[model samples]
Target: MKTLYLVRHAKSSWKFDVIDHERPLNERGLEDGPKMAAHIAAIMPKPDLLMSSDALRAKTTAVFFAKAFTIPDTEIKLNHKMYDFEGRDLVEVIKSVGDEVDTLMVFGHNNAMTNFVNSYGDLRVDNVATAAFTAITFEIHSWQDLIPGKTIYHKAPKEL
Candidate 1:
């Protein structure tokens, strides 16, 4: 079985004058991001591969999970495509994952995260809050052949 954990970037600060891609996490995100990452790590197995969008907010959120999993910086991949708000780019990235990876953690934006979970996971999630962690287990052998899978786990900041 392959397990995919999807995490939406922690809440970002609109207070910045920078572009959307450069927006940093707000105070709440800093506090909740690590907590949620550590909480999830305590329950589930560590990811074989950890990836994140190049966007500052997403990358920062991924760092929390990487630390919790004890994943080295060299092993973490930063992808530009994941910066997509739409789910298509994210889908392509996931489908392209090598078979060697049985577990994967992805940090990205929403509408994409929410849409992916709703479409690919059995559970119907109305929204994926900032720093929310959602896991889906697939019975398929390859990431290329994705089907609707069961939502094995889900946790948000407020739920913590």
Candidate 2:
């Protein structure tokens, strides 16, 4: 079985005069990131691979989970493709995951994250909020065959 963790990046700060990719997390996001990360850590198994978008907000959100999982910073893989707003790139990235890794965690933006989860998982979610986490377990042995799977959990900061 293959487990996939889909995490939406924390709320971003518009306070800074920066590009969308460079905007950092807001105050509420900072608080929520760790909270949500710890919440997920309690239930999900340690992932074989941790990946995140290279964008500032996404990367910051990923750091919270990395800390909670005791995963080293160097071990976290930052991928430019994960910066996708459309689910296509996200799907491509997921499908490309090495077969050796049974579990994977991915931090990215929405509606990409939300679309991916809803499209591939059994559960239908209205939205994947900031610092939101959704886990899906696939019965297939290969990442390439990403059929619809069970939605194990979907947790957000507000829900916690």
Candidate 3:
């Protein structure tokens, strides 16, 4: 079985003069990112791979989880494809994952995250809030054969 963990990037600050991709996390985002990461670390297994959008907000949010998971900087991969908001690129990224990876974690934006999770998981979530985490297990052996299995867990920062 393969386990997939989907994390929505933390709330970003629009107050910055930077472009959307370069915008950093807001105050609430900084607080919630670590909080949610710590909460998930207590329950979930360490991921075999960690992937995140190259965008600043997503990368910053991922850093918290990386610390919590004790994942080295070299182990975390930043992908421009994951920056997609439609979730199609996200799906492509998932399908490309090697079988050697048993558990995979990805941090990105939403409604893509929400759409992706609801598409393959048994659970139906209206939205994936910032710093939200969702885990789903697939019965298939290959990432290319992804099919709905079980919605193992879902956690939002506010719920922590």
Candidate 4:
């Protein structure tokens, strides 16, 4: 079984009126990042690999989660494709992940994240709020085998 933890990046700050990609996490995001990380650490198995969007907010979110989980030597890979990627792009990225890591975590933005969940999850969730988490379990041997309706857990941090 392969487990995928889809984590939307924490809330971003609008302090700077700049490009959306340049925005950083807000105070809520800072607090929520660690809180959400602890929640994930309590139940989910340690992820062998973590892939995060290159965007500032997304990378920061990944760093916080990785530190909270104490995943030593686990680096946050910067994937530009994750930024504003559609469902197909996200799927392709997952499929390209090295087989050495069975359990994985992906930190990215919404629209695509929401699309991915709706396309792949078995349960019905309205929206994956900022810093929210959704865990999906699949019976497939590889990431490519993961398809719609394979999710086992669709939970948000608020629900925890």
Candidate 5:
């Protein structure tokens, strides 16, 4: 069995003069990131792989969860492909995960995160809000199969 946790990057500061990929998190995002991360860490097992988009906002969000999991900086993976918003790159990245990883955590943007959860998990979520987390447990042993799995949890910062 495999468990996947998909986390959307927190709210970003649009006030920045930089490009979209360089936008940093806002105050609320910074607050929510650690809260949500600690919440998940308390309830779930540590992830075998912690991956995030290389974009500034997404990577910052992942750092919070990584710290909660006590994952070293060297163990965290930053992938530029995960910066995709369409979910296609998300699918490609997820499918390419090694079989040795039984549990995986990924931080990225939406509608990719939202689309992925709706299509690959049993639950139908209208929107996966910022700093949201959704976990799906699949019966398949291979990541390449890409079938619908049981949606175990969907958490939002507001609900915490």
Candidate 6:
């Protein structure tokens, strides 16, 4: 079975005068990002790929997991598509990942993340809070087969 880890970016700081894309993670987010990454390391198999939104908060969150998982920085891809609030776009991105990768992690924002999990993930969860993670296992051989109720585990940061 293939596994997909959907993680929401850590809490962000509004104090930044920069653009939304440039906003950084708050103190809580800094602490929680690595904590959740360590939590992920303690349980799931190391991720083969880490896809993230171009936003700084998302990239920072992904970085923690990349380091904890020992996945090379080259394996992480930052995409602007994820910055948009379309869950389908995220799904398409996953589907397009080469079939060679079996386990993938995506660090992104909510509304899209929550919507994707609720639609494609088997678990019936509400919001995937900041630094939260949900693991979905699928029977399909490729990412294209993802569907609701296909997920087997939904783990949030709080749960960790």
Candidate 6 per-residue lDDT, tens place, 45-70, comes to 98888999999999999999998888
User: Which window of 10 residues has the lowest lDDT sum in candidate 5?
Assistant: 67-76
TM-score for each prediction? 0.98, 0.98, 0.98, 0.91, 0.98, 0.93
The reply for model 4, stretches above 4 Å from the true place, is: 72-74
lDDT of 5 by residue, 105-131 (tens): 999999999999999999999999999
**lDDT by residue (tens digit), candidate 1, 52-150:** 999999999999999998887568799999998989999999999999999999999999999999999998889999999999999999999988899
Against the true structure, candidate 2 reaches a TM-score of: 0.98
- lDDT string for model 4 (1-160, tens) is 7888999999999989989888999998998888898888888888988898889999999998898788752477889988865666778888888766788899998888888888778766677788888878777787777765467665565666
Candidate 1 RMSD to the real structure: 0.7
Residue 119 error, candidate 5, Å: 0.2
In model 1, where is the ten-residue run with the lowest total lDDT? 67-76
Mark the 10 consecutive residues where model 2 has the least summed lDDT. Answer: 67-76
Off by over 4 Å in 5: none
Candidate 1 Cα lDDT to native: 0.94
Between candidates 5 and 6, the TM-score winner: 5
Error of 1 at 86 (Å): 1.2
Clashing pairs in 3: none
In order, how many clashes per candidate? 0, 0, 0, 0, 0, 2
Model 2 CA RMSD to the hidden true structure, in angstroms = 0.7
Is candidate 1 or 4 superior in lDDT?
Answer: 1
Off by more than 4 A, model 6: none
Q: Which pairs of residues collide in candidate 1?
A: none
